[model samples]
Target: MYEFCPHCGLKYEVEPGYFYGAMFVSYAISGGVALVLGFILFYLAGDPGGWVYVAVIAPAMVLIAPVNFRFSRVLWLHYVAGIKYQPEL
Candidate 1:
């Protein structure tokens, strides 16, 4: 079930125990987004007073949690599935 890198479109084989990198990528994206939002709120409020941003965006994040989960898997598979795409017949 080796795959290709979607970002770079590089075809490569997935080594044993290699899929874990996808989880890291997903977490990095999600957590980075949250942190950036938090920083912006704090900066604009002159303190941590703008919790409304967190309250609103946090739940939105939760709602999209499933999407994020699936996205990670799909991203990994895109790289590791080794499935090639061809134009329609």
Candidate 2:
């Protein structure tokens, strides 16, 4: 969660509440993770009980929280905000 990028001196937040969109991105990422994990567990685990999904998906989301947060922000910045990489800058 840098206020600015050290390598390029680029400010991370373009405006107030800029990152609010990132929350939705994070939600989408999380939902996708849960669905994928649930599907995998459903098939590989031989269609275990409902509690099994709750048990596995809960911890898996927690474990991937940090990665999901950063990834969502990066996705928001690169896709929604139209921030382009300036390799020369």
Candidate number achieving the greatest lDDT relative to the actual structure: 2
For model 2, residues 57-83, the per-residue Cα lDDT tens digits are 999999999999999999999998798
**Clash tally for model 1:** 7
Model 1 misplacement above 4 A:
1-21, 50-57
Tens digits of per-residue lDDT, candidate 1, 57-83, equal 688678767788768766776766755
Backbone clashes for every candidate come to 7, 0
Best candidate (score: TM-score): 2
lDDT of each: 0.69, 0.93
